[model samples]
Target: MAEASANIGVNFPPFLNSSSPTFLPSRTLKPEFPLTSKLKPNTWRTKPLNLTAFAPSSRLTSAAFTQTDDGKFQPRIEADNSRTGRVFFLDVNPLCYQGSKPSLRNFGRWVSIFFEEVSHSDPVIAVFDGEGGSEHRRLLLPSYKAHRIKFTRPPSSKRFTKGNFRTSYQVIRDALRSCNVPVVRVEGHEADDVIATLVEQVLQRGVRVVVASPDKDFKQLISEDIQLVMPLPELNRWSFYTLRHYLAQYNCDPCSDLSLRCIMGDEVDGVPGIQHVAPGFGRKTALKLLKKHGSLENLLSAAAIRTVGKPYAQDALTKYAEYLRTNYKVLALRRDVDVQFQDEWLVERDRRNDSTILSKFVENNDRNLLVQPSKQV
Candidate 1:
C-alpha cells in the first residue's frame, strides 16, 4: 500500500499548532449511541445510519492538541473539566468486509456515518493495511493467517471478487482524502502495528483516543485513556469497549491479553492452540494458567521448575516451550513502527461538512445500484 500524503496548505486549528502547549476546552457532548449495554449474543440490529441525523449545528469545535517548541505535543487542559480532546484512529481493513456483499457503497456509507457521528472538533485519522501487511507475521510463523489463503476460493458473485474489494478500498481512500481525513498505509506494515504505534504516541501526549474497528486483536491496547468502538452490523450500531468492558469480558488485565492469546491461539489467524498439541487443554485451562502465572514467560519459568499447573500442563509447557514462545512473538503487536502523528491528518470538520465529495460518492454507489453484475475487467 502507498503512503497517503498530508493535506497541504490547510490551516491548522489554534490548539493544533506545534508550538502551543494547551488544547482548547470544549463542552462535553453525550454520545448519541449507548456506551455500555448488555446485549444477547449474536444479536445485532443491522440498520443503516440515518444520514439526516447529522444536524448542522453539531459541527466539531476544539482542536486536538498543541505542540511545544521541542516538537512534543502538550496535553490539553479543560478549565471546567468538561471534555478532553479526542483523536480517532480508524482501521479501514475490517470495514471492507462489513456487509454481506463488499462494494464501495457499503464501505463509503460507513465512512460517512463514522465522520458524521464523531465530534467535529476531534481529529480522525484513517489507517489502511499496507502491501504485504501480514508478511512479517508470516515470517514468524508461516501459518499466521495462512488459513485465509488456504480456504480462499472464487467468489460466487462477481461483485464480491478481489477486484471489487480493491475498488471499494480505493474509492473510500479518495473520499476520505477529499474530506481532509488523513489516510495512512505504510508499505510492508500491517494497520494493526501502525495503529498500535499511533496509540502509544498519542497516549504520551495525554490525549484521549478511540480506535474504530471490529478486530479483537485491538483488545490488548485497551486502557483508561484509549477506547475502542466496534461496528455492530447486525444491529447497525457501534459498541464501545473500554477498560471496564475489557476486564468484564476477559477477567484479566489488558496487558495479559497477549499471553492469553498466545496460549489459547487464534483460529481466525490460523495460529494453533495449545489444545492442538496438548489434548484437553482449552480456554479454561489457558485462563487458569494465565491468571496464576500472569504471562507465558512467567508460566514457562514456573514450568522449568515443574511448578506450573497440573503435571500434564507442566509437561506440555516444558515440551513445547519453543512453540509457545513463538506464538507470543506472532501475536504481540509492535509499538515501534516508523509512523508518526501529523497535525495535517487532523480532520477539518468545517471543510469536511461543506464538501460534497462523500455524499456524492454514496449517492452514485448506492447498494441498490451495485446488485447487478459488472463486466469482467
Candidate 2:
C-alpha cells in the first residue's frame, strides 16, 4: 500500500531569487592598516572594522541563517537565556474515505492552531512523510504491522478513497508554511524516521528535542534530553515521558538490548508476537522470560524454564523465538536519515528572540493568526 508519489511533491518556498544591491564586491584595499605580517599568501582578510562590525544591527542579512559559523549551523532562538527547543510534529495515518474534502485547508487550520498555541515559546521545525512511506515498511517485513490490515467483511462494492487524506495533509503543510514554519519531507522514508534523524542531529548540539506526535513507536527515542511531548487542547494538560520511565512502564529496554521488540510483536505492524499472543502481554512476557534465561537464544537452549504464565516455555519455544526475531526488526526505528540542512538552519537573528520583531510579519500574513499572546499559556 504505497502512497502515490504525486502527493510527495509538497511545494516549498523558493530560495532567495535576487541578491540585494548591498551584496557588493569588496574593493581591494592597499593595506590601509598593515596586513598581519604573517598573513598567508593570497589570503585577503577583512581588517577588523570598528565596534559597528560587532553590533547586532549590522548582521541583519537573512543569509545569517546559513552563513554563521561558516555554514555549519543549527536553529537557535535569539541570544537569550531561554532554552532552545525543537518541536517535531508528524501527520499520521490516513483513513481512506469517499468524496472531495478540504484536507490541506484543514491541516492548515491545525498548523495555525499549533502555532497559535506554542509559537511564542520556542523555535519549531516540522516534517511530513512523503508518499509510499510508512506503507513501505510493511513490504520489507511481511509482519511489520500485519494485524491491523486484517479484513473484516467479505468483498463489497465499497472501496478505499484518499480524497480527505490528501486534503488533510496539504492543509497542515500550507498552514505551517503560511505561518513561516519550516516543513520538510523526503521521499521513501516515514515521518518517524525523518524525525529520528533530526532528533539525533540536534541532541548532540546541547538542544532539547521534543517530538510532538502521538505515535507510541517513538518511545524508542526517549532519553534524558530527548523527551516526548503529547500536547492537549488544554495547554497545561500535556504529557511528558522520559526513556527511563518508558522502559520501566513498557517492560522493554532499548539500552544494551536486542531487537526482540520487548518480546511481544506489534500487531499494528503485522508482527505476531508468540503466535497467538497479544500486544502488550507478549512484550511483558518476553522481557520477563529473557531476564531469567538471558537472551532469546539462551532462553531457547535452556532445558527447563520457569514462568508464571500459561503454555510452558518449551511448548511455545519456536513461536516465542520467531516472535522475538521478527518483532525486533519491526520495532527497530531508523535513526539514520539524510536531512541536509543549509548553513542557515542555525544562527538566530536578533528578531527571533523578541515576539515584537515578528509583529509586522503576523499582521501581513493572513495565514498567521498567532499573535504574541498578552499572557503565556
Q: Would you estimate the TM-scores of all the predictions? A: 0.71, 0.52
Instruction: In model 1, state the lDDT of residue 39.
Output: 16
Please, what are the lDDT tens digits per residue for candidate 1 over residues 225-292? 66677777775655566654555566564567888898889988878888889987778888778766
RMSD value for candidate 2: 16.7
Tell me the tens digit of each residue's lDDT in model 2 across 1-377. Answer: 22211111111110010122121111223332332312222222345532111111211222222224443322223442222323334433321111122122223333344444432223456666665555656655755543332112222223323332233344444534444455677777777787777766765543455666556677666544455655343443334454434444544433314434445555545555564654334555666665455455566656234433456545576445555555565566777777753223332111232233234333433332221112100
Shift of residue 290 alpha carbon in model 2, Å: 4.5
Off by over 4 Å in 1: 6-83, 99-101, 147-168, 346-348, 351-355, 367-377
- Which residue window of length 10 is worst by lDDT in model 1? 51-60
Clash count, one per candidate: 11, 22
